[model samples]
Target: MSESETTSLEAVDIVRILELLPHRYPFLLVDRIRDIDSDRSCIGIKNVTFNEPQFTGHFPTRPIFPGVLLLEGMAQTAGAICVLASLAKSKKPEQVYFMTIDKAKFRKPVIPGDTVEFHMTKLNQRRNMWWYRGEAKVDGAVVAEAELAAMLVLE
Candidate 1:
């Protein structure tokens, strides 16, 4: 889609997020999307809770959200941006697959009741591949950060 066309969108709710991405319960980390700047950047929300399945096994007593999941959430946000842009241009949804993750760092331990905000920015796009940089924050404090690469498969 043209820059202006996709940039017209300001936010995407759970319903739209469900339609744009394939992830479902237990795996779908993004609850809502806001501050979308077309395919350039976006913010994704994930509400962490004690009842989450991962917490049951990841740490029965300590219960810290997994770092890898944080990266996955950020990647999902980037994928949402790509899907939204593609839908705007072709009216067809595509699947985004993780290609690589680099320089991932965990800055803090995310526990239950913490709401994570995933901020993702597109660094570049070449053909079907997209490069992104993302950070996961809890209450304005960064918990994780990473550089991601993904491939968009046209369906």
Candidate 2:
């Protein structure tokens, strides 16, 4: 691991996450940000449960977490990092809008009872647009990955 990866990160709990993000329960995918390296990278956490509404219809039997939702979770993780960085610079947290998703791949099915860890790194940023690469892991196994782009809407 490089020095940037090894550097210790401060944890941001659910309360702070909620303040930084505009999502709410049932739609909010991220539980907390486990570690943050400002605008460079961060790790996000989500505990999957059978009670989640998606599981009810995603599959009545042999329920599985939706791949699109996994992608959304990763996007949310990236958003949190940007929001934290903005906050640090004394700028109000702006709403991040998805610009694009590319090279998305699902390697394994995520089910209820699995704890997902979303690891995201900044790939590039120009003006208000940011690009990121992210992976979703369960118990150290990669379940999903994607390259995503977003734009900050300052209002």
Candidate 3:
């Protein structure tokens, strides 16, 4: 609602994103959130660094960002949107569970020092289930995308 948030490029620190998502340390794919619109949409940013564990064996010497990891980043970014829309303060991320992924594609290889941005938008909802479509990019070039589905599980 504020001018900075309305501008659509605000940055979210890792701690803030961790508060909404269950991922952490080595497994947390997203580095920060740049923007979020509750349930409507979310943009997450990740800075790939040479220190990542995957770089060791993903190639041993010439590391190419794995396509599945890119897809995972996109899904996690979308998951952050879902959490903000439905579970910002529930104490955990399993309250909403991912169910399916469809129509996924990879267009480029993401490498170290690249900052990837994942943009996700809500497509629809069915009862406790939510559907989203997303794209991941680096330097405005699409690196990955998918039609994803998730279910909000309650305790």
Choose the strongest candidate by lDDT. Answer: 1
Q: By TM-score, is 1 or 3 better?
A: 1
Top candidate on TM-score is 1
Better of 2 and 3 by TM-score: 2
Order of candidate numbers by TM-score, starting with the best: 1, 2, 3
Candidate 2, residue 33: CA error in Å? 0.6
- Report lDDT (CA) for all predictions: 0.90, 0.85, 0.78
RMSD of each: 1.4, 3.8, 3.6
Across 47-117, the per-residue lDDT of candidate 2 in tens digits comes to 99999999889999899999999999999888877766655555664587878999999999999999999
Clashing residue pairs, backbone N/CA/C < 3 A, model 1: none
TM-score of 2: 0.91
> Which stretches of candidate 2 lie above 4 Å from their native place?
1-9
- Alpha-carbon RMSD, candidate 1: 1.4
Candidate 3: Cα lDDT at 115 = 93
Candidates 1 and 3, the one with greater lDDT: 1
